[model samples]
Target chain A: MEKLCRYETDRVGYVMVLPYIIFFLIFVGYPLFFSFILVFHKWNIISPMKFAGLYNFNFLLHDPLFWKSLRNTLIFLIIHIPLQIIVALVIANILNQKIIARGFFRASFFLPVVISGVVITILWQQFYSFETGLFNTILSRIGMTKIPWLINTKFAMPSIAIMATWKNVGLYIVLFLAGLQAIPSSIYEAADVDGATARQKFFYITIPMLNPTMIMVLILSTLGGFSLFIEPYVMTGGGPINSTLSCVLYIYKQAFYFNHMGYAATLAFTVAFIIMIVVIIQRKLFETEVYA
Target chain B: MKRIIFYILLLIATLIFVYPFIWMTTASLRPEREISYLSPLSRNFSFGSYITVFKRIPIVRAFLNSLIVSSSITISVLIFSSMIGYALSRLKFKGRELIFMVILFTMMIPFQITLIPLYVLMVKLGWTDTYQALIVPGMISAFGILLFRQYFKAFPKSIIDAARVDGCSDFGILYRIIWPNSIPALVTVGIITFMNTWNNVLWPLVVIRKTSFMTMPQMVVLFTVGGQAEAQVGVQLASAMMLAIPIVIIYMIFQRHFIASMAHTGIKG
Candidate 1:
């Protein structure tokens, strides 16, 4: 009986984690494995899936819409990556000091992070309205004529990038703030004592110390850029001529809207593969100080 | 002089950040006829737009569905993730490392990659249009587990050791010792999970086919493009504001925690 009790404790230690393991298999592991199988099959629910064998991938390589989605997604990353990091770091630096209303300022920044994306999209749609929008209101006040924020193909992706940045900047601000606080005051004091200019101190002390945080921010923001859907979907309808159609959004359009499940699944796998490759290359280059 | 300039810039930045939301609330207040012609900020606010938004669609029901899904996901995540986190952190069990590696691998894979296959799985199970579609899949979150594990690993192990020596059971150590001491981390996970599930669009769009099962974001998507005619912009804004305001209220209460949780998850996920 004593031996049995001891063995039960020994075995139960691993047993306690059974729930998470089961859930991981169901939700994550199964789906990941199935996506591989799905990429080759041309089945749209109810029809028997034929083994198309590399044809789906071939189509993806040649499809203009796929290429366009990729281009738009890259365009999104271009606008969002640098903008998200810079704004977040600036806000984090400003708030990290002995500022008054620190909590209030922090909340004001983080407020959008909690609001639903669809809501933000809907909200920004009105904000982008050509005539009565607050954007045009500000522009007209600045003596510039009204601009088509979402309707103009050129402006639409940038506008989505703007909204995406706002939605996520709060989280990055906190990250930078954490990184900033982890820097001891002694380093800054030593820099100040050396008569180093504030610019030099910021560039030399702050930037170098925050490298890991910056890497984390870069990986995260890039991931976010790839997954974007709601902003462009709601604000641009992926249009005013497909100007803002993101890769994930395009995949959704093909899979759900048009029932091109095989093509959509293939496109989805390519994106996931691309994200992995991008992160791998990024890690290599980041370690080598090669900025992409 | 520098301080003044900084303050002024901060003020202006805050205004720019907040202007659209303020405009949304004000726009939702204006009379229906006056929506597009008048300035969104200049008009006297009215509750008529709110009435119209509520009346035109299933806004109230959608809000409740979102509340249910977000809360369920958050609560379930907190319970399950914390359980696994405590084990992964404190238990000297075999396969703990393997479990963490699994969590990490799953965390890096984006949702869209798994989404199509998961839909097929749901169809096979005949679980379409049920709350199970929204709640079951994401209740085991990698980000939550990582956050809790990181936090709990830092928790002094002496307490658990003492409890074990005192003949407390394993779950006893978890329930009485770990959970009571884990309020901050739990709240952090709770805030983030609630917000993510609340804001989720793509999954809810795929799973919940019936208009009656629609969550708030899905409803906003419906109002935006789930139509033939031009949706009344004012009513759409009103519905969006309604979805945003409550979650934003919870976020405002736990704002610092929200940022901290999300920041940590960003690094670890």
Candidate 2:
């Protein structure tokens, strides 16, 4: 009876996993393999695919617009990741304290994250409006000149990054709060006994202890920053001379707008490749810097 | 003294974070010409913008489409992921390790790389502009499977052994014995999946061109960005409010669960 049950269990295992395997193959496996094949061929959706060796890749190498979008993405990341870390960490540290209405504060901060990005983007687009936006209206009321937030190329990407930070910082705050909780109260007690000042404890003990969480925040923010499409799409349409055009937006335009499937595939592959390299380098640098 | 300072600073942060939303709520009620005034104290307020939005688009249908797509995908993900999770965690099967590794591999490949081919496949299958375009591709997630597998591993195997010895079928054991007891995993996966699908704009934008099939976010974005609500800032904000309010209600009701599950998952839509 045990032997018979063992065989049935094994068969059941196959049955259970089979659905996912089929879904995986149809949705994930085939798409992935097709994407690989697409990189080496030239085809619009309406046309039969013609093999083109490395032409798409060669074109991508020299595509100035593609390079510009990549530069824009890097700029957004540079501004976003640091701002996100500082804001999230500071708020998290503050919330980690024994305070009044901590729940209310946390919920308020996290509200934007749960809402649709499209909605937030639309709201901020209006807020960043050049003429009558709230920021500029306040500026004008204070006897100052109104600065264009999203209209100018120079201010556009940075402005989006700030909005992105606002939307996402709450998540990181929760993460950092969790990390803050994990640090033993005993360490702080030890520091107190040693006559350590608050600033000294924060810099010397808290910062070092929070290294793992900091690395995680860094990675998650990087991945999040790379997926910057909706904000720029809704707000700028990658305009103001393509200043805020993101990597994904560029690929979307290529694939859908121009119907350059093969070339877009090449760009997609290249961006994905770049993201992997950047993430791997980040891990190595942060791990060695902190651990060493 | 320090606590007072912290409180003041937090109050400032709260205003900065929550003030825009407050402004949006008030502005959506203000007349279109008075939108720039930016004060809740303004005398003029009406339901004109909300009515305009309803006149402009089929919002009720779009809401239902979003509801149907999100809930169906969430339920499907919960069932399929747990089943695979059970198999991977408890049962011994050939290629189990390989399957686990394959799912991990899929998780690493960003959705952008495969997007074009996936679109082409959708086109070839004649699924574009259909509900299948939105629902089918997202029915199973690599992350969901891995999350379930990790959760199921911690579940005690002695109970599984006992159930098996008691002549419970594998499906019976999973559905009756394991799943009922695994509420945390189920809720985490379900909420995240539903929220992601609800807020998703890109895939729906890519696949569904028909107005009848547009999801709520997609419909709102297109309506606002496509210039239908041009010069009608109040109407645009009204449409946005309609999109945001449902998610906000859900988040408020399940505030603790939403935060805990999102933080735990570390996966954002």
Candidate 3:
């Protein structure tokens, strides 16, 4: 009886996971493998794929637009990640206090996150409009000149980064809040016994203890930053000299607009490779620095 | 004094996040000329823009398309991922660990890596511009599968054993027994999948060329970029509000789940 039951269980298990196995192969596995094969072949949709030995990679090496998009993504991340961490941490810290209506406050911050990115982009684009925007209207009300938020090359990426942070910081806030709550109250009591200042307690006890959460926020932010597409695609169309072009957005254009499938595949692979390297470096730096 | 300051600071931060939606709502209601006005009280709001938006595009149809696509993706993910999760968590089958690792590896490879090939595959299969293109690739979320696996791992083994002793089939056990006790996990996965699909713009943008098939976000984006609402700023904002309203309503009802979902998965697409 036991042997028969074991055999039936095994069969049932295989049957259960069968659909996923097939689905993964067709949807994920094959495409992942096909992406590699596509890198060395030039094929427009209507034509037969022609072998182009390293030609796609060679073009990628010299692609100015690709380089610019990479730079823009980095700039966006540079602004976005730090701002996200600080703001989210601060808000999370505040919300951790026994404040009245904390739920309302947390929900308010997370409101933008749930709303579609396209809606936020359109709303912010209007707010960032130079002449007749709400931001500019308030600026003029205060007798200050309107700052061009989206159009100016210097401000465009930063503006989008700020909006993106506002849209996403709520998520990290919740993360940080969870990390904050998980800290044993005894630790704070010990610091209190030592006559530690609040600042000292925050830096010494809070920050170090939240290392894992910090690393999580960093990685999530990095991944989110790399996939920065919809905001720029809608807001500026990677516009005003491609100042806001993201790697994903650029790849979309190359593959879909221009039909450079091989080149686009190469760009996608390179970005994926860079992301992996960066994530690994981050894990190493964070893991070693805090532990050591 | 410090407490008052803290309250004030929190209020200001909340304002920064919450005020935009309020502004959008009011702006959409205002006439085009008054849209740039800072004060909602500065003008008599009207529904002219909303009327114009409805007249200008098949927004109702777009909403239905978004509903169909999102619900189909969500349901499929729920059903498929739960089954895989049950097998991987409970069943001691050969290659189970290997399959789990493969799913994990699939999660790491960014979606852009497969975007071009997937599009080409769709073209080859003549699935482009159809619901299949929008729905098929998203049918099985590896994240959802992992989430369910983690949830099921903690499920009581005694109950599962009892169910098997009672001659309940594996599928029957899953649907009748394991699932009834896993509402939180089901809601989390369902909401996350639905939200991601509903808000997705990139995939639909890649595949769906016909306006009739375009999802809400894609349609609204085109409505904005194609200069359809050009010179009618109020009308543009109205369209954006329509895109946001349904998701906002869902968020309002499932506010806790939204936060928990993100904190649980941390895999916002």
- Colliding residue pairs in candidate 2: none
- The numbered model that scores best in lDDT is 3
In order, what DockQ does each candidate have?
0.60, 0.74, 0.76
Candidate 3 local lDDT, A54-165, one digit each (tens):
9999999899999999899899999999999999998999899888988899899888888889999899889989988889999999999999898899999999999999
Using lDDT as the yardstick, the better of models 2 and 3 is 3
Name the 10 consecutive residues with the lowest summed lDDT in model 2 chain B: B33-42
TM-scores of all models?
Answer: 0.94, 0.97, 0.98
Instruction: Provide backbone clash counts, one per model.
Output: 1, 0, 0
For model 2, residues A200-255, the per-residue Cα lDDT tens digits are 99998888888888888888888877788899989999988999999999999998
What are the per-residue Cα lDDT tens digits for candidate 2 across B94-190?
A: 8999999998888888778888889988999999999999999988877888888898888887898888788899899999998899998898898
Candidate 1 lDDT by residue in tens digits, A1-292? 7534553345555776899878877878888888899899898878888899999999998999889888898898899989999999889989988988887788787777677787777777777888777678778988999989988999999998988898888778888988898888898898889999989999988988888888888888888888888888777778989888899889989988888888888999999899999988887777534221
- Sorted by TM-score (best first), the order is 3, 2, 1
What DockQ number belongs to candidate 1?
Answer: 0.60
